[model samples]
Target chain A: MDNIEKLKLTCLHDLHVALGAKMSPFAGYDMPIEYAAGIIGEHNAVRNACGVFDVSHMGEIGITGEDAEFFVNRIFTNDVTNAPDGQCFYGMMLNDEGGVVDDLLVYKRGHNDYLFVVNASNITKDEQWILRQADGYRLCLEFMSEEMSELALQGPEAERVLEEVVGIPGADLAFYTFKEIDRDGDTVIVSRTGYTGEDGFEIYGSHPFIRQVWQALMESGRATPCGLGCRDTLRFEVGLPLYGNELADDITPLEAGLGIFVKLDKPDLVGGEPLRRHKSEGGPRRKLVGLEIQDRAIARHGCEVLSPDGEVIGKVTTGYRGISTDRSICMALIDARYAKTGTGLSVKVRKKTFPAVVVPKKFYKKSYKA
Target chain B: MIRYSKTHEYIRVEGQKGYIGISDYAQKQLGNVVYVDMPDMGDELEKGEDFGAIESVKAASDLIAPVSGEVVEVNVALTENPRLVNVDPMANWIIAVDIADMGDLDDLMNQEEYDIYCLSESH
Candidate 1:
């Protein structure tokens, strides 16, 4: 039996099916996993040329009011106070125990207005958590998930596609910055940001406006219509953490090797104390590291990571036959003792144990616009 | 005679030898097969047990054995280019097994029955 009752539909659902996309249930939404070009073709297109993804399934929450900055800083790990309007900061919201509640992109749209872009799967959890933290803070919460749609235009040729084909002229925006512009009488938020390790932009707008943009990009025949399949590969190659895989409710940013995003020096964040302690004392038991398998077989998620002596150290968080780098690599959360570079490790893939070595988590270098 | 299992594995028997692979419907559902993990030629495969895995870009699914047998030959071409499975799943059989129990064929569905079974499953 099909489990379509609880599953939501994205705005591009009909369009995806029209283009012969392989639809699958992801994060409670019937989303496109790939198009007719397939994952490999779509993945290579984003690395070499331009590709667009209907990331409308992602959740958006807006926080507005006087205490927006202070209140957000109290819950979020990144130092967003120093960031000016139009600046986007990537960080996590953590629980009191230093475990990640969710990792999100915080966009400061105005002095009192902030937009939080979070993973689709964590929408309800994140909203509830934020509502709980909004008790004493002077803020108004607006869940903009259903009303908004997002498109990620990524690759080396993304800027050209956006400027000429999509007709959104915010290509001049610096990386990690965004601006609201009038597009055919509709206000659209265009951010010079992406998850694919390539130079790209993320456009957030109303469903109608997003639909128009999607159609234009599709009709231009330049931007490949990518799916969540290639999106995972692209992000994994660049070592970006997917919430469920890398940053779970029990996993802290420190353990996930995202310490730079955790602004512990700032006083009184929800999970600050525990994260600070971890930073100061090296308290995290496990650390995230990259492992290169010596064999052709991929070491998939949940595979056991072991020491040469046969002791289970950790497990693989994410793995791929990296489309960009062309290597069978995986990021594993292993014991801190064996997380160093060049450390000998092995991953038990099904029956046979394959030899591996600890390498840097960044399997492919990012080509983000400076 | 070719028989299809409820698990989507198909076995084509030629005397004592049987060539095994996932059904075309199963391959289409998998989409853009990237890797096909198979047991070695000498590995024993029990009925209804997972022999290996097939990986697509989005996920990996275990390939189950429809009948008890010992792996006699594996399709080596799939190791170099796994996309062959997606191109033609029937032509790109995963392994050839020496049938341990000829009676196990009765447990599977024939072409006509399997077609009806797949039609019901889709709905």
Candidate 2:
């Protein structure tokens, strides 16, 4: 018997292949890394104009019941208690030891109704973890990952594209909020949220509806068909955290430099006690910090970070030659003593070690129209 | 005459010196070259040794030497614009090296043989 696990395909897989995109395996899916114009072209298109991404591989779960809001607040670090409908909260689901299970966005669709958007690679693990936590809650959990498809129309021109090209009015929606629209017979959810740190919208619907929207956007010629290669770069330029790199099963949200999302004032949560204690005890032993390398060599994930005296202090989580900022930068988890801004450090890139300095994590300023 | 290595590097022989660069297939595989790290002049390179690195937007790749040689000149053009390799890998040789041993050429594949080798490796 062939034991090789088959990779999953999203609704836009055929279209991506037709466009001559460089395809690679990502999170168990055969996804596009970039197209003929390459990563730089696609990246510039998003920064200056607009780009559309097939983010359908992202997992979605629906929770509806009398205790839906209460249950979500218990598992999530952000305090979403009594949040207005259509509002979205970005936070993490933590384990008992305060490590991250996953970072996700929770949408309060209505009273007693919620939706969760999670990382594509963590679909099975997130489902099992959420189900285990749902043992006592009076809520109905529905796994809609396979049935749903998503598209992110991002950049400065996203609103105009949505209104004129896709025939959807998205200017009325506030940042981090969403609205459900009835298109013909299918209900499509459109949110003014994105990971690219731009003014954009995330549209969710059935596979057919998503394919139709993708085709229409591509035909319009205003939105560039971007792939995951530029998507990672765009997010990295603005200092966003990727799950497996920045946050992991053993990396806590506080340690990942995302303490702002973990609401400490709320009632007890799944990992609340430990997180609160960790905070009260003067923060984590190791912290994530940004490093600016003096040389042009790109520091990548798993590269060792060393102190000025040559001690192995930490490891790089993510790094790149910032397309927008035009500098070699990276984020690393290192000892608290070496994480202070302006501290001297160095990174081992293959055969040589390059000098670096601790800097602010936000490499590029975000241009979100909030 | 030109020769290729299994690792996708190529050498175009001229007298006792040869111009070296990655193969066209290798450049296409490594999308969007952003930077190239090359060795200084007079540095010695052994057969199948990593002489430098080539980085793209997503990842980096090592540039392996197909034959033992001494670095005569580093392509300074690549330092300013590395994408020249992606545009034309043959014309934009990465380095010029003095051949240390003529027998090293016997181990490399010629154009026709290398073409067939690349086809077989792709599958």
Candidate 3:
């Protein structure tokens, strides 16, 4: 069968087609890349106003039982023990070798119930990993990816749209917190969390409820219908690590510059020993850094980074001519010695080389609500 | 006369010189052109050969030559504002070249043929 025949479609697929969106296959799903307004417009809308993304393709897993909290803390890098109900922690699940299996968000719904939102592409792998790690624990896991649909209403005007347009009371939510509300017999989870650096709410509910909210927001004309195209650009600008790009199976979170999230002090944490050793040994051999290209040519993924003497030392993970910043920047994994800010390097884009300097990975500062 | 390649590039023939740019449909598909990588003046481009590339916010595409020619001038304005191609792709020709052979034009499609070709591909 052809790729399209095997691809999955989200609940918003028909709506996206009706809106003249450019559809493409992403993570085994037929996803909209952009609407007629284009990536730049959609991107700017989220930066300056409001834009909503159909994030239904993301995987949702639920864990509950007497040992849910302990099971989660053992598998997750972030400390969630005794975390208050409705608190969410963002961290990674690492393999025994300390390489990242997936970066995910664990929401502490209550004393023993947790919700996990993971990348769309790593659903199967993550489910199997979670199941394998759940052995000998008194916990029940539910993969609710197909049963749920999610929308991310993001930007400066996101909270206003959530209140006025979607008619959801999300203004009280602090950053990284979530609450479940019963709306017309359906449980809708609204969280003040998003991939974009903007102040946003990620609403999760049944397909029908999500479709209703999407229609309400679209009909009200308060939020632009965004796609995965700008979603990537926005996240990249904020220095967020995409799983396959910045944090891969071979790349550790410590090397990806996410040491703060990895709680090496947490007792019996999976992969904690190696991570401690890695930290105690000064750090990983390679490190992720930001490179600001001096030329107009875009430095794309896998482009080689070279020293001034022309020795290859690194490769670009994610690069873009940033929409908000208007500067060509990229995140690259380079030799730790050359990962220092202000270090001069060059990137080979196809046939030409451009001068670049190591800078902070965050090309744009986040405007998340305090 | 304007002739089109299956790759969506168009060559506008005028005397012995030809101006080349991507079609309007191509620009809409590309969306928000960020950079256009063009060959320098006097660079030789062969028929069906890729001479340069075009980048949008999400992805990049190669600019394939429809016919052989020597680059006489590159669109310098695109260096400053590549979105000019998105605004008016035909008006903002990417390069002007001296035709290597007028016979090369015979291999391209006309307006009607290219439109139908695009329609079939879109479906």
Candidate 4:
């Protein structure tokens, strides 16, 4: 059963192979790691112009019926009921222990019909958790993962590329907002949201149509083909926390420094009480902070972060050294005392003690379309 | 003379001394080489073992030794300018070793063999 319930493939899986993309397992699909042009070329391509990503593996499930808003609001810690139509709110799906099940986006298409954009790897878990949450509630929920393909066109030139293929001006779409555009009698919800910290749009539609759109956009937009390698580095540069690295079943939003998106004042929501108490009284024993090493040594995940006196403080969650930065920068969940803007520390990588300093990150300030 | 190991490192061997670095194929595969973690000059290295690390924009990889030897020299330029490897990997040998395992070179790729290997990959 486990082997049979293997990872799913997107419509562009064939294209990835044809383009000589080094494929690897990500989320639930055999996705590309890098192309012949390599990750650096892809990373620089996105940073300079536009890059097209086959993010079709991301899950899209819808919730409907009259009590949909009420049901979603109760399950999410954020004020889901507050968003007007065509707006998306970023929030988390939390377990009873106040740890994040997954960080997701809630799109309010209508008062009753809404979409939940979730991480690809957690689709099964998210779907099951939602079903359990809705079983005793008054809402009709549906997992639309089988019915949709999601694609993201990201980079500084995302708007230009998308506008060319979609044949519609998308520059007006505000951040975290979506519009149902007519594309040959099919409505694809195009949202001005992306994970690369660049101005981009995510389009959702049927499998075949999504494939056609990918081919069309790749041709007309002249976007560089990017794979998981560039995607991970780009997202990391922007300080986005990946689920497995920064978020765990035991990792709270407070520790991840994502509490701004979690609303404590919300009524009738799961995990709000503990989160509120955490907010007021401080429950985050450890907090994620960005570290810019003074040297070239890369501090890998799980590397020991030590105090000046050689006491263990925390561990590196993710580290990346890029040509653009010319130095290694790491993110570690450390005690709040050392998480200050300029606290100096040490990272024990292998047998060497590399000098580390805390710095404000989102390493590349977002250059998103307004 | 350019020689390569299956693990992707290449060296220009001459007598008891040689300059070492990754092959063009390896550098091309790794993408925009960024950081290189070089061991101190006197550190010992074993054949087929990791001597240090090389970071590309996307990820970091360990640098494996093609021959067991004592590290008699290192390219200090790498600590400041890692692009030297990406610019001319053939020219920038990472280490100067008193190769303890001289016979190990036979098991690695000579320039002609490596050239054919790269050619096959294109097809």
Index of the highest-DockQ prediction: 3
Please state the error at residue B106 of candidate 2 in Å.
Answer: 2.1
Model 1 CA deviation exceeding 4 Å by range: none
Clashing pairs in 1: none
Candidates 1 onward: DockQ, in order? 0.58, 0.74, 0.85, 0.68
* Residue A196 in candidate 4, Cα distance off native in Å: 1.9
* Candidate 2 per-residue C-alpha lDDT over A195-276 given as tens digits, one digit per residue, 9 for 90 to 100: 9988999999999999999999989898999999999999988889999999998999989989999987777689888888
lDDT of 4 by residue, A308-350 (tens): 9999999999888843565688889898888888899999987
Q: Give the residue spans of candidate 4 off by over 4 A.
A: A1-7, A322-324, B1-3, B101-123
lDDT of 3 by residue, A226-260 (tens): 99999999999999999999998899998999999
Recovered share of real interface contacts in candidate 3 = 0.83
Residue lDDT tens for model 1, A1-370: 3598678888888999999897889999999989988888999999999999999999999999989989998898888887789999999999999999999999998898899999999999999999999998889999999999999999999999999987777657999999898877877999999999999999999998888889999999999999999999999998999998998989999999998998888888998888788777856989999999987678899999999899999999999877777677999999999999999999998987989999999999888889
The 10-residue segment of model 4 chain A with minimum total lDDT is: A1-10
TM-score for predicted model 1 compared with the true structure: 0.96
For candidate 4, give the docking quality class from DockQ: medium
Please state the error at residue A295 of candidate 3 in Å.
Answer: 1.4
Model 3 clashing residue pairs (backbone): none
Query: Cα miss at A154, model 4 (Å)?
Result: 2.4
